[model samples]
Target: MTEFDLIVFGGGTGNRVASAAAEAGMETALIEKGPIGGLCLNRGCNPSKMLIQHATVANRVREASRFGIDASIDDVHFRGFVREVNDELAAVADRKAQDKRDQVNLTLFQEEARFVDDRTIELVESGETHTGEEVVVASGSTPVVPDSIDGIDEVDFLTSADALRLETSPERLVVLGGGYIAAELGYYFDAFGTDVALIDRNETLLHREDADVARAFTEVAEERHDVYTGHSATAVDESNGEFVVTAETEEGGSVEVTGDELLVVLGRRPNTDGVGLDATNIETDDRGFVATDDRLRTSVDGVWAMGDVAGNAMFKHTGDYEGEIVVDNVVHDAGREVDFTALPHAVFTEPQVAAVGRTEAELDKSGTEYVVGRAAFTDTAMSRALKLDRGFVKVLCDLESRAVVGCHVFGHEASILVHEAVPAVRYGLTVDDLANTLLHAHPALSKLVQKACADAVDAADRTTE
Candidate 1:
């Protein structure tokens, strides 16, 4: 038996927590079954974004003639682009993983770890039992391939994970689901000159966003691909090397959609079952997510869980925050609670959508009195000069306190622009504070954020008068 002060299962963000513990002079060990950087760095966010950037640049060149620039793209060369991006991202993740392994005085086990008892885990590689004074589980989630649809097992399909490693572009692609993954990949394939058909059960895509924002994105999506909303996929079958997707709409009409390949992006399920949780006293929710309190502590003593496995927010940024919270509580003995309020998220679509804090519907449901300020990018001098049209920024603020309650943006570089408002909302900065703040560079996209804030203050004043 190998005894340590702490042992963390799953490398992802758990690597950070284990490193923090080891730096504090605690004996620690990290166990990872897959690549050390986990899904986000290796397969999910980093690689996907790199591929999307290629498509974006290609699209820009294709439309360069609109700006009186005669730029012609000879070929997309998608396979070459994907290979380069994947290789670069994998190298970075590998280096970071190795650095963590080298710096910390911790044992790195490249094998599956199963909980043997309340405070012990068995590393399957050496069949060694390691007991820790404290344990942290950060095992992440995997894509969910629903069992309800028939013939899906026989048909050739791709998940976001597989799509990232595609060697050749499909002549026609069918994507199922309305989430960010589906939208992004569908857009990517379409921009690469593939015929894309996107199907979702919801009435509008990105249903979690504001209605107006969702509508604007859907319009952009429809321009390049066939978008079928309010339709549920009933079955998927293969015919002569092609996939046939049968869907029934809310109106009770049957529609058949076919393509060279199908990519399902329904959702992800937490990787919690059969990993020895049943052998221990660890508690899990009905959906198999490890149950944890605000402090990221599991039900059992001397054990904690974070990231996708803990069933908090599933985003990569959320996982990073959870890792920090766990480290603070375990190391510094700080009992800081997790605050999800004003947490930010962005969807990397054509017209990128970024949001922080509450939505109009959420505020209305809570009966919070608020005022809204909105400004269109099309109204800006920069937008006119660049001939970029589509999307706007809307700011919501509390009427009484004048504090910014929420900020939502959809348009060029919206993801980057939303970072400016994060501090304002997080620190309860009032609309007056934003309006009076100095904004540099008149032609920059940031001016739109400033304009939106000023417009919001002006709207509040009119309502009061």
Candidate 2:
């Protein structure tokens, strides 16, 4: 038994927590069963975004005629492009993992860790065990493949992780689900000249986002791809080396679609079970997510959990914040709690969608008094000059405090533009504060933010008068 001050399970965000402990002169050990950077750096966001960037460039070249440019795409060379991006990102994650292993007074266990008791975990490597104290579980999540669909197992299927590593592009690809992953990959394949058919149970794509934004997104995608909504996939089968998907329509009609491959982006399940939590005092919710308090502490004493396993917001940024909160409580003796208010999220589609804080629908459901102001990118000078007029920014403000309650954007660089409003909403900055600030460089995308704030203030003043 080699006891330590902290032993973190899962190397993704757990590495951050372990570093904090070791930096505080506490003995820390990190146990990982997979790559060091976890899903975000290894398979999820980083690699996906890298491929998306390549697709973006390819798209620009393909449509260069619209801009009066004679640029032509001789060859997509998707395999080589994907290989370069994944290989480069994997190298970076590996280097960071190694640096953490060497820089701190922490031992790295390249094996699975199971909780043996409330305050101890047994690191298992090839059926051998090593003991530790003060354990932290951050073992992330995996793509969920539902077992109800008939013949789903007959044909070869790909999840986002496996799809990212694909060297060959299928001639016809069928994507199930309308979430961010499906939308992104669907768009990428369509841009790469692969015939894509997107099937979803819901009537619109991106059901989690604002309805108008979802409609706009689906409209753009439909222009170049096949979209089937309000239909349920009843079964999937293979016919002569092709996948045949049978879907029952909302009106009780049957529809059959066929493709070369199927990509299931339905959802993800937390990777909490089978880690020997049943043998310890750690409690998991009915959904199999690890239960944690406001301080991110598990039911078991001296044991904490974060990231996908913690079961709050499943974003990487949220996981990073949780890591910091756990450090504050465990090391600095601070009772600092994690506040999820004003958390930002984005979907990197053609017309990007970025959102922070509350939505109008949420406010309406809660019967809260709030006002919304919207400005279209089409109305902006920069958007006109660039011929990019696909989305808008809508701001929600509290009626009493006149402070920014929420901000949602759908358009070019929405992900980058949304960050400016994050601090404003997090700190409860008033619309007047934003209106008075001198934003730099006219005819820029950021001017849209400034103008939106000014318009919000103007509307508020009119209502008062």
Candidate 3:
């Protein structure tokens, strides 16, 4: 048995907690089965975005005729491009591992860890037990693959993780699910000239987004891929080196989509089950996520849970934020409750989508009185100058207080553009407070956000009248 001051499971955002504890002079051990940086670095955000940037460049070149540039993509050399991005990510992961190894008080255990008791963990392969005064489980998440699909076990299919590292773009790709992962990956392959088909049970792509945003994204996706919305995949079969996906349409008819490859991005499940949580007194929710209080402490004393396993939000940014709270509460002994106010997320598909705070549906469901304001990108001179066809922003504010509660955007650079609203949403800035105070540079995309806020002010005033 090896005793440590702290033991951190997972090297994702959990890495932050472990590093901070070690920096604070506590002997710490970080146990990760794979890469040091976990999903975001190895399979999820970082690498996916790097690959999508190539797709973005391809898309721009393909659309350059509209800009009168006469630019064309001669050849993608897709395999080499994918290899380069993956190689770069692997190098970064290596550097991260080496840095952790160099930390004087931190031990890097590149192995799977499982809970033994309330305060003890065992490395699965080594069978070495380590006891900790404090434990943080940031084990992250894994892609969910449903067992309901007939012949699912027999056929070869790619998950979102596999789609990121796929070297050769399939001649035709069938995507299951309509969330951000499916939209982004479907766009990536389509931009690379792959004949992409999207089949989802939801009525629109990005169904969890604001209703208008979902409808708009679904329209844009339809222009690029063979979108089969309101279709549920029933089974998968492979014949003659091609996959045939059978789905039931919303109207109660059967449809088949054949493709050279199939990618499933249904959703993600927490890694709580993998960590041997059942062996300990640690409590997990019905969905298998480790339940934690606002302070991110698990039910067990001296144990904390954050990241996907905590089930607050699955984005990398959310995990990082939770990690900070855990580090402060555990290392410095500060009693800081987790603050998720104005939490934001983005979809990296072409004509990207971004949002902060609550959606109008959420507000309505809660019976919270609110007013909405909307603006098209075309409302701005910058959008016209750039010849953008489809971009929109919607702002929602409290009907009485005028405090900005939610903002949604869909357009080029929507990811970056949405940040301007974050401060307003986080600090409870009113419509007039943001619209009247911020100085948006002329001909900048950010003017779209300003325009939306201005529109919100008008709507709020109208409501009062």
TM-score against native, each model: 0.95, 0.95, 0.98
Candidate 1 vs candidate 3: which has greater lDDT? 3
lDDT of 3 by residue, 1-465 (tens): 988999999999888789999999999999999998999999999988998898888887878888788886667799998999999999999999999999989999998778879888898899999989999988889989899888888988999888988889999999989999999888889888899999999898999999999999999999999999999999999988899999997689889999999998999999977778889999999999999998999999999999998999999998988988989999999999988899999999879999999998999999999888888988788888778988899999999899999999999899999998999999989989878866678889987777888888999898889
- Model 3: what TM-score? 0.98
The candidate maximizing lDDT is: 3
TM-score of 1: 0.95
Q: How far is candidate 3 from the true structure (C-alpha RMSD, Å)?
A: 1.2
lDDT of 2 by residue, 82-123 (tens): 898889988987887787779668888777778666656676
Which ten residues in a row are the worst by lDDT in model 1? 96-105
In candidate 1, which residue pairs clash?
none
Which ranges of candidate 3 are over 4 A from the true structure?
none
Q: How many collisions per candidate?
A: 0, 0, 0
- Between prediction 2 and prediction 3, the one with superior lDDT is 3
What lDDT does model 2 reach? Answer: 0.84
